[model samples]
Target: MTRFDAATADGRRELFADAIRAHDERDSAFLTIEAAGNGANAGNDAGSGSESTPWVQFADGTLNLDCTDDELDRLKSLLDEFPSFTVDDLTTPEDVDGTNVRVVARTDDERVGEFVDRVFQRVYNRPDGYRAWVTVV
Candidate 1:
């Protein structure tokens, strides 16, 4: 499949976030999309599951739906129109300049794991790889 990258840093972030929201929207459990903290920012985890928990923050620094999967393929297909959607990164998550959207709704452990994964994905990955991510099925 063809891979797509956002035109600008902000666009890249938003593209990733869109893929996330699209995939997450597949599940009925995902009910809401909220903002979160990052970088030097103090974050606003208002609509969350429990205290001190992590969440699925998207690229562009905002938005990831929750409340939760079958439609994952369908939403992924939508990326075809974007010209930048890639299969690799969608499975994984990235964070640059505090753009990853908050990932709430899941267990605290899962949230934290996801958070760390995003950081590592961007940190370890090369050049624009920072915008790309690697994940397990």
Candidate 2:
């Protein structure tokens, strides 16, 4: 399982932002979060369609979210802090959104390597890691 290393929603969000920002070259960026909310379930059931996936498309500077402006504003505010961490050695995730959010980093305009490639490589080669995925009905 791509471990929920972070405990709370904000923690996860911070982790996500950190992942994107660490590779972020420009000051501005777009954030994308793939989420499947369970209708009125209150997280009582543990299956599909009850998780959220967020991504920061630094290349395009856009945030993929299915929420309101208020939500976006809050996220933007959080990003303004801009925390940093190491993604190269994450416990290796089984997937990104459903498997792994592949993050590639370029050097001087040339593709050097994936920033968070380890997450996939470790699992891709060994096929054993932690990842949480729930398909919405």
lDDT of 1 at 8: 33
Q: Tell me how candidate 2 scores on lDDT.
A: 0.30
Estimate every model's Cα lDDT from 0 to 1: 0.31, 0.30
- List residue ranges in candidate 1 displaced over 4 A: 1-4, 28-122, 128-137
TM-score of each: 0.25, 0.27
lDDT of 1 by residue, 1-137 (tens): 12333223344355444445454555323322222222222222322333222233333322242211322333334334323323333322343222222322232323333433333223222132223221100
TM-score of 1: 0.25
Worst 10 residues of 2 by lDDT: 109-118
TM-score of 2: 0.27
Among these predictions, the greatest lDDT belongs to 1
- CA displacement after TM-score superposition, residue 71 of candidate 1 (Å): 32
